[model samples]
Target: MGDIIRVRGLEKRYGEVRALDGLDLTVPEGTVLGLLGPNGAGKTTAVRVITTLLRPDAGTAEVAGIDVLADPMEVRRRIGLSGQYAAVDEHLTGRENLEMVGRLYGFPRARARARAGELLERFDLADAGDRPSKTYSGGMRRRLDLAGALVAAPPVLVLDEPTTGLDPRSRIQMWEVIRELVSGGTSLLLTTQYLEEADRLADEIVVIDAGRAIARGTADQLKRQTGGERVQLVLADVADRDRTRVLLGEVCRSDVRDGETERELAAPAEGAATLMEVLRRLEEEGIAVLDIGLRRPTLDDVFLTLTGHGAEAPGTARTEEPAR
Candidate 1:
């Protein structure tokens, strides 16, 4: 596939804060590229630069063969963007919101209405099309927001945290919709905090940290780069935690204890073989293991290993809340 979006040496700064610093990215035609990062990692900044909402301090970006800096209007015409929040007008009906966006895109009134109806039906929003957006659920409003973006039928879509705060079922539904779009040949740049979402939807994954691209690869490739497999051991008794740790220390090079019931170990061998050996050792030691298994390293593991922080780590501003 040809490259539909290309960015190089992008940089952005706000006063003393450097939002983006020498970032680069590429998206092949008809594939989804997942952009993963923490809250302040410049994912949103990248999206803004690509969508022409904000100009970069340095570097260049191209969308659909048009240079974003040289011809931002042309890039805008060929791209759609859905940001973190649904941008629907609360007073407008769902259909009205989409039709309004279509008109803003320069579709004729008739064409806009037709397009709106088509998208409403396609997105399963037809039944709610006549209701005001304020009456819609979070999922419905999000679907409608996405429908608005597609009204222009752009070749490239930039979705920023499209599934944030959605219920599990709604997130799954949105994922299916994204798959359908990609299947029909739309190039997508999706910025998300959800590792599982990236693992499921992204053809390639880019991990960003502190305004820089730290890693990029397919999900499996990233996992492999993290090295080895994960072994989860759940002890039969909380009292055995210390003894279990000592026993695991023989074969496990790294371990994390979660409360009293669970401990995670990282082994340098393939998970299954290492798990079997560990189980044997436990049995010989009369450890009475309750559960044990081998599993592939998750995207979370990669994030933690790379940043010395978990993906779910709260932003600095929000870290002062008392734990419930």
Candidate 2:
């Protein structure tokens, strides 16, 4: 499949504040590309530019062979977008909101009505189809908005934090919905702050910071790039902390990490072999273990490594550029 969304040298600025500075991205057909960043790293700005909702101050974006700047209408026709907030109409019934989207996209009245029903069913909003969207839960309303985006059955989909503010159950439901859509061969560009979400749904991930692309690769590749493995042990008795630490360091041939918690001791574990060796030695030394496991580097590690901040850290809004 070809690149359905292509962006190069994209730039957007609000006076002295740069929302996007020489940003570049690409999403191939039938794949989900996760866009991750700190609160103001231009992920939302990039989505707007690709969806033709915001004009870029520089560079080019092409969606499904249509240049977003020169022919945004054509690009819009080939793509669907669900933004950070649910854009459903409060006064409108869930069905009506989707039907309106279909009508706006030029579907015939009968087809629009039918498409609305199909989307409501597909998104698991069928039971609430006749109710005013204002009466729906946050997840229901988000599903309605996503259904509205799909009313025209566009080949490419762009979602910006679609699961934000959703409860765990709702987030999982949304993930199932997204998987179903992608299974049908729709290419997707997803911008999300949830590291686990990206880990589950993305075929590739792009991490941006300070308005520039900082890292791009598959989840595992990025994890490997971040560094190696670590083993965490919960000691039944914290008295042996020093012994455990020294044993782990000797086994893994490196220093151990500390201070997160008193009972939990963490150390670098090069691989399963090192972990096994540590376990054997700890047993010999009469160390009590509550729990132990070797874990590879996670996306959170990658984010902190590349951006110098964790994604869940409190973020100051980028006030210079209002989110469009």
Per-model TM-score versus the true fold? 0.84, 0.84
Question: Which pairs, if any, clash in model 2?
Answer: none
Candidate 2 Cα deviation (angstroms), residue 104? 0.4
Output the lDDT of residue 248, model 2: 80
- Which residue pairs clash in candidate 1? none
- The prediction achieving the highest lDDT against the true structure is 2
TM-score of model 2 vs. true structure: 0.84
In the range 1-324, model 2's lDDT, one tens digit per residue, is: 689889999999999989999998999888999997768878899998998889999999999888999998999898888967438899999999998999999999999999999988988889999999999998988888888888888999999998888999999999999988898989999998766788789999998876888899987777666655778788888899988888887887766776346878676677788778888998999998988998765645666566655555523332222111
Candidate 2 Cα RMSD (Å) = 5.8
Stretches of candidate 1 exceeding 4 Å from the true structure: 234-284, 288-299, 312-324
The 10 consecutive residues of candidate 2 with the worst lDDT sum are 315-324
lDDT of 1 by residue, 187-303 (tens): 999998877789889999999876778899997788777664667677767677777777666666555434222443334445577678778888887887666777565555676
Query: Looking at candidate 1, what is the lDDT of residue 269?
Result: 46
lDDT of 2 at 24: 89
